[model samples]
Target: MHSIAFRLVAEEEEGRLMAQRVERRKLRDTINPFELPQSLFEKYYRLNKPGFQYLLDVLTANTEAPKKAFAISPIAKLSACLRFLAEGGYQTGVGKDCDVSNKESCM
Candidate 1:
């Protein structure tokens, strides 16, 4: 029947859409925040290198360890947080700056 054929076509379309969604999701490339020049780092994070290192050291134990291989590192998380605070921008913008694809990760 035409209804049965339409149902099959719908299922095929759904499968193709799922494949496209999967293909679009990929691990985003990240940059090392610590590798930035000291001035640029301070400018973005509003903290000097030593202060940032101290904060990172203090917070490292409190931060959740990455469960997945592609999970963001604590350093990146902190950098994103500080950047968000310093820049007063949207989470997505901060995520892009931190190379985090997930805006929630920037939070």
Candidate 2:
């Protein structure tokens, strides 16, 4: 009888611990309350798009006079990508499951 009661208590403790573990995992999936603003994502896309478009514009701007703007026209896309890479492009190893280096080249 005593052994049965001890086993029941142990089983209840195990069940409670399992429930806490599940709750912790759910909380882990939640976003941090002190994270960056959502507006930042909008700005990030906007900034990259314009810079990327500008780079393409210059690239296809003129086939006739490649020598004219051949050197550099003060664009932003390549620079931005390079800059982002330099500034740690898409971190993943520490905690994330995806990083830019794993999928995309810096250039």
Candidate 3:
């Protein structure tokens, strides 16, 4: 009976340690220079992506939940569009997805 109690406590402690590790990784990943939003980045336009991903991770994780109409800054939108163009896919797909206004040049 005592052994069971000790095991339970140890297991709980182990879980806590694992959670800490995960948080640390999350924090480290966010600090990277180019982190972009995952929802935005996953659309395959990710060039110089790691840094964008890290920034997005940090921003989103640190902030309050956004509204459905969440808007990215214009510069980021342009950058994302450019990345899409360089990668040979239309920004329209990502734009339609995020419900963003399609830039005329993307088509």
Predicted model with the maximum TM-score: 1
Q: Clashing pairs in model 3?
A: 34-51, 34-52, 35-51, 35-52, 35-53, 35-54, 35-55, 36-52, 36-53
lDDT comparison, 1 vs 2, better candidate: 1
lDDT (10s digit) by residue, model 1, range 71-100? 666776777788888888856454455333
Task: Write down the worst ten-residue block by lDDT for model 2.
Answer: 97-106
Give lDDT tens digits, candidate 3, residues 12-36.
Answer: 9999999998765443333221343
State every prediction's TM-score relative to the real structure: 0.56, 0.32, 0.31
Query: Worst 10-residue stretch by lDDT in candidate 3?
Result: 97-106
lDDT on C-alpha atoms for all candidate structures: 0.71, 0.44, 0.53
Predicted candidate 2: what Cα RMSD to the true structure? 17.6
Clashes of each: 0, 0, 9
Give the distance in Å from residue 2's predicted Cα in candidate 2 to where it truly belongs: 0.7
Model 3 CA lDDT for position 13: 100
Model 2 lDDT tens row, 29-68: 3422114244542243334444545655676675343365
lDDT of 1: 0.71
Error of 1 at 8 (Å): 14
Top lDDT prediction, candidate number = 1
